[model samples]
Target: MDDDSATGVAMTRNGSTGERQLEGDYLTNAQGEDVVAGIRMTKDLSELKKEMPDLYAEFERIALLLEKHYREMQDMEFTIEKGKLWMLQTRDGKRTAQAAVRIAVEMADEGLIDRQTAVRRVKPEHVDFFLHPQFDPAALAGGKLLARGLNVSPGGAVGQVAFDANMAEAWAKNEGKAVIMVRPETKPDDVHGMLAAEGILTSRGGRTSHAALVARQFGKPAVVGASAITIDLTNREMTIGERTIHEGEWISIDGTAGVVYEGQLATMVPDIKDPWLIKLLDWADSFRTLGVWANADYPRDARRAVEYGAQGIGLCRSEHMFFETDRLPYFQKMIMADYPVERREALAALLPFQREDFAGLFRVMDGRPVIIRLIDPPLHEFLPDLVELVAELADLKIQLKHAPDMAAIDALLSDIRQKEQLRKRALSLREANPMLGLRGVRLGIYIPELTSMQVRAIFEAACMVVKEGIDVHPEVMIPLTSHVNELIRQRTVLEGEARTVMAEQGVTIGYKFGTMIELPRAALTADRIAEHAEFFSFGTNDLTQTTFGISRDDAEAGFLIEYMEGGILPANPFATLDRDGVGQLIDMAVRKGRASKPDLECGICGEHGGDPQSIALCHQLGLTYVSCSPFRVPIARLAAAHAALQETGRPHDE
Candidate 1:
């Protein structure tokens, strides 16, 4: 394969030839002041070299287990060098553009790595995630997790937990407290609370919901669809079935895992400097310089600004394009319209609005790999109920006068009535439990036009940008894919349409189609998904929620908090990772995906990207990259450096 400038020639499948070559390069780079910048390198230590069931040793077991758990590229520091592999250190690694600076420059200071090696480590894309507002572990501990929900945004908060938007604003009104607004879901009215609250929460909504969009717009922590707790807006209180709680109660919410607790719980912010992180990235930098990309749905996610540096965006969701009001209306228009033309027209109305949104994003990224996930939600989400529509028709005929206006209303009403009937039938056909139901690819299967409009808009944006000479690598990803057949089907529709539009406009472009490995089925059947997918981005958020059978929306209000507080659940699986459970799938998926397709690009786009421990794990796993919001990039980069440097402290390998 050709190099993308940042990547270098790597070792082959066999370790002996590549290992010897890498050793020579390692010596030269180590000696010169500018070795990294100039020397082309490669190191391939395959599974065959690392695997030997009979060569049993403590470190070997540890290394094997670490590899088994992570299922990706691994850099482990072991006590033994030749005879055995001792577990001295382990971390998934990738360098931030800044950390590349620090490692190459600082290593020179320490007489370890020289200046040229530093520039080689730094890449154009890697530096971007570092430039956002990141939390110092001290800052994370500075505040508290009053109540936990999906931490859509990374970092910490010190604020009064207000139940409603109004309370959030009122509390934030007086002074020092950075208000953390709690809500069952956010509305346009909640915009103020979103403005006032340090973070936001919702009873229902996906990564592409109103609450997520508004919070991301404001750069606030958002935990959406946390339906575990019922909010009593009338009583100014909330209920999690048996437990009743009122407003003004101070609690910490872990937006990462949707875990809400009674009071401030102790926090352990994983350090970007953990020795494990440094050792890992150093190993990655030693190989191909392929710019690592992150999948981001929001601008504030700071994909470019995470602690563990990500090169740029691999996927960015565009339909996460509106606030509460716009979402329902846009959805309603798509669902309630009498004809495909009507719905397509409604989507057309949203086009200019979407283009403008992408324009701002283009500005944020400047020029990088921003793979926009086209609209992938079900149409029913936007439509009002048939029962409600029927009721409206009855009210109009029974209450209004008999005139031309009424006649026109009657005609339109008849069409609406037919559409309502079909919609009702569709609902009945839907699965009893819709989370694993008629969503994702199914929506595209029936409503192929929905995917069509989104693909066109994305391409139009690309064309708009391309005409300006801006290089944009747009990636289209299919969500909720439990089956490989589903991804292939969805891609056929999306790619087919995108190609058509490209041809008509006389614009040439290239994009990758991939699936988000967020389900057990997706992971278990990864080899199949890889056959159709150009790359893979592990959607650990949904993956975790589905894996635990926890309502990401409601888990916090019920018993997850209790479980964490009582030490039943070590940490919210949403916040940290449940390595044994969900991680096992990620490990399986990577190994299977690679086994089927060597050189398959893989990465993580969940909240774990900024997490120091998770980042280290990604380093050890041999993942292509770990992506978080832009703000968290700097921290990710530093964490990557730590994983690399940790190798130094390992009881010298020899």
Candidate 2:
């Protein structure tokens, strides 16, 4: 064969046309000249088709035949050897989420596959990626790359960098600027900043870190564990190599790609108005046996969940309701109160706000089961940082020492006294390990009033919404119940407050009381706990932490990433379910709980609920549902269908 005559051909079927199309064809040497630097210039596909029409036709025929055999789009590579067309390789073509959707729909339309098979072909992540904004290919190519990190959440974000949570909140809220929260690692206290920011970036932490979890919950773009980036909190800047990104500097991040770039990059939001996605999800709903629910706290989230086809609100975290600017002060007052009367007064002030919050969610959910987990975090989380309070007090003392007048001295002394008291209180409440300390059921039991207050608020809200002609199914879940007695105690408080509210409103409302199976002991003794509880929502976030004896936030930001990368661990157990350890616990709990009450309703309301692998396990274990963030409802819906289809080996209709 002549060197110039040898040609390579690549072909694929156009999704819209189903016609064999030559993607590219190139000759080894167009001029038949000696190669310079062992490189060969090539002729284009048009030239190849013009010169060798029969050869091109033969390749096209072969491509179509391969595609037909595979029953999918075939990417074929071929070459001419000794004037004869030779096939090199052929396989299913890889495609983008956009292409995947278009191909699936077109293939179904072409009668190559049924609608159910089309739904099964596309993965949940593909659907999720289809919904998020992505960096424009042209703009992304032109942009200067800064660093790369774990793609904790899927989306694109453009904003000015903010070093801390307060700066992020101030910049976003006060100046109306879109801020990217740049933190070493985020704590629960930094949630306000995370909520305000357009996206979150952290120098440390893996995909299941606090930053990752909250970003997913809020549906914000996030890149965590960017080890290349060094955050200097004191200087309000992050350094990547020799490049320093100061606070208020423009930066864009591709959370899906996990790439950080300097300055703004244009992004294109996917046309979520695609009819194919709607059709695919409809098919998913038909096949799925496991219920898909949303971990929604606010009415807005609930509404979005409904729009995305969430069957119900699986986890309504009541603590998130108190984090708003208008409500935090009252909650803090309640936390800092020295006496029960003072605490009750503060709780009384917060009751109306709580009621309104729950009522709004209930009204949006429209009678779907809303499993509301009562206040779970430790009290110290609500208070001002002890370090910040101490610093302020030290500054105030310095001012008091140099007071120029009696009036000034008196005012300084008053401020000093208040700061001192707060510092003391914060110190007293601070725990060596807050996660294992006074949180969840312990906090509620320590101050039964807190549980009573939240339960009353829930009942009052349900009653209010019920009277407004809205159906309400409130499932009050007690968090972190290691002992059956704790559930027994909290259930009594829940029922009493519920009865009192129903009597006051002159209307009875139906509600279920339940406990979150977060601790090993709780899982071990699930039968006893189930005896008192009407439902069990597995809080796998803490359950994983407790089972592994690792703090999720600390571990993910530290050794957990190493564990995953070093091959000591298969995956981040926080992100995917630890099927052996945590899964065993869950399976045992479900079996034991069902043994006690055969009709016991069980589900998971953790970060894992949104994970496809975990959702599959939950399906295998016969859990009732999986509750993820509002944004993840569609993903869960599709994943649940996949789980069901995998089990049954056919669509629901078949």
Estimated TM-score for each candidate: 0.55, 0.79
Worst window of 10 by summed lDDT in candidate 1: 1-10
Name the regions of candidate 1 deviating beyond 4 angstroms: 1-310, 322-330, 363-367, 378-380, 383-432, 647-654
TM-score of 2: 0.79
Error of 2 at 178 (Å): 9.6
lDDT of 2 by residue, 270-373 (tens): 76557778877887888889999999889998998999889898899899888999999898888889998999999999999998998999999886999999
Clashing pairs in 2: none
- Identify the leading candidate in terms of lDDT: 2
Model 1's lDDT to the true fold?
A: 0.60
Write model 1 residue lDDT over 1-654, tens digit each, in one string: 111111112111112211111111211112222223664342222222334334333433554455446532234432223434334355643333334444444444444444334433444234332232333435345654333445565433435567777777777876656666766666556676677776665666666455765565445656767767787778877676576667766555555445455554444443445342345344444433223455566656533343345567856766567434655566556665668789888777777667666655555565566666655554444555657766775665554445468677677677656655656754654455667766666777777877777778778877777788777677777777888888888888788888887898789877778878888999999998999988888888889999999976566434665575457887667766678898889999999999999988888887777666676677667788877765556556555544554543332211
- Least well predicted 10-residue stretch by lDDT in candidate 2: 29-38
